[model samples]
Target: MIDVYLLSGFLGSGKTSLLSHIIEQFKKEGTKPAVIMNELGKLPFDSRAVEADVPLKEMLEGCICCTGSEKMEAQLQMLLEGESFDVLLIETTGAAHPVEAMDAVYSPLFASKLNMKGIITVADCKRWLDRDKMTPQTRMLFLEQIRHAHLIVANKIDLLTDSEIATVTMQLQALNAKAPIIQTSNSKLPLNIMKKIEATFHEKEINETAIGKQLFLSSRLHTFQEPVNQEDFECWLKELPDTVYRMKGYVPLVGHKNPLLFQYAYGMVQWLPEMIKMPPQIVIIGDQVDRIDVLGRISND
Candidate 1:
């Protein structure tokens, strides 16, 4: 049976970073792995950043736990039949609830063909602590992502002091007393930990009420024709409306020769230089955001 690992976490929790590391290790061991990236936005960002040689299938425009499950299953079927891989990794969107994602895995079609090695949940130390500041639905979604994991990876520990680290460890323990907690910065962890055999599914522990609630969230994608002034765009990103939860895409800057990749989560914003030439486009995921207003603001000179 193929070993399948489900990597679940909140937005910006370093899931992709961790996945890259896992893929590199697999390469060293002469094992080929397949990746299934579940993205909440229509335009892919995290998948593009991942450096892997294996075949990658993207489930975009919706979370795999809900509307995208059928597509995900079809992709998995194709991978299993057409390719030879030692392991399969499913990287879920930050907003995905573990219970629902697992349900897709336990479906009749896939349950017999693959063995779930473990459910690894990556938790951003800072964001996990401040989750209460978000809306009720988002806060619950964050908690539910951790509740069912066999391993809870408390990432971004480098950002915390020793005292802060201890406090965060205690908080994670309170939230998930059963799962083993591993702390790391930049989502780094020992390869042996992932290879260890562990119990994969916990159907009895799933909270049925939380399974279908995330579908209420809204998402919109917008494209811009002109390059934006770097300073002006940064200022606007900093003051984005509270309704916007996650924003990411590629943008061309006024003076820079190459376009830049941008990602914004809550109050944090990051811009990285890119070599590829792609049209200026962005995907915004939030609740009740006005599409026309967002387009006007982004298109402003």
Candidate 2:
């Protein structure tokens, strides 16, 4: 079992700095930690912040709540199959909601492989009290991140006075009564607080329909002697319902005999020719279709 920690904060709230420190600390101790950096757009700037030598997977082009869970699930599954790692760190998009991202991890596939290592919310103390200055959407996103956290880093304390820190910490407590607040300058959170902490989350039951509406993955258990058509595959993808957010797997059409490697993020798709005689195994998860109803059909066909 791996300890998966979700590191969440508003944009530019020093999430990268804190996570970088965590990564570097582990590296010094001769340990490797896997990170899943969730980005809001196609530009994967956040993933570039860490050392490429360490394994860091980037999930870009969709929000964890609505458009990216299927890809996220597939990526996590692939990682679980690899060399054992000490921990999993997920850095959510600043515009994303933490609860929805956490809820998405509770799927049957990841049920036992991962355990919650607590959610950490990093707050910019200087901007913490300026609720009126933020846009409605930004404000909602910030509060939601704080509300679901088990540990909060009231960060950037150097920019604030004692009174300011006290006020902001109180506000955070009011929003998240359960989370322990830590005052920090540059996200100097104590590592001990995060280690072995049991998370307490009173979340709403996630309906599978919501899952279907987001993940578009569907796979079959058939041996295709013939390859699939590139143009026809593209056409089928284009005609799929808008809910199908990401759709690319080891499926081959009629022309190319090899596995037609594909990857779709948001609406952008890429096809790469491959050498591995991969089984025609495909997995699509997003708000695309009823997962069991849709995925099970693939095995039947």
**TM-score: which candidate is best?**
1
Cα deviation of 69, candidate 2, in Å: 0.7
Worst 10 residues of 2 by lDDT: 292-301
TM-score of each: 0.91, 0.66
- For candidate 1, write residues 1-301 as lDDT tens digits: 8898899987778888889888888888898888989887777788875565688888887777777768887989888888888899899887787767866766677777899887898988888667777677776777777877788889988878899889989988887787888999888867788777476453546554232464345677778777887777777776776557777888788877767888877667888888878768888876655543664554445
For model 2 the TM-score comes to 0.66
Error of 2 at 146 (Å): 0.5
Candidate 1 residues lying further than 4 Å off, grouped into runs, are: 208-216, 295-301
Candidate 1 has an lDDT of 0.78
C-alpha positional error of residue 214 in candidate 2 after TM-score superposition, expressed in Å: 17
Best-matching candidate per lDDT: 1
Query: How many residue pairs collide in each prediction?
Result: 0, 19
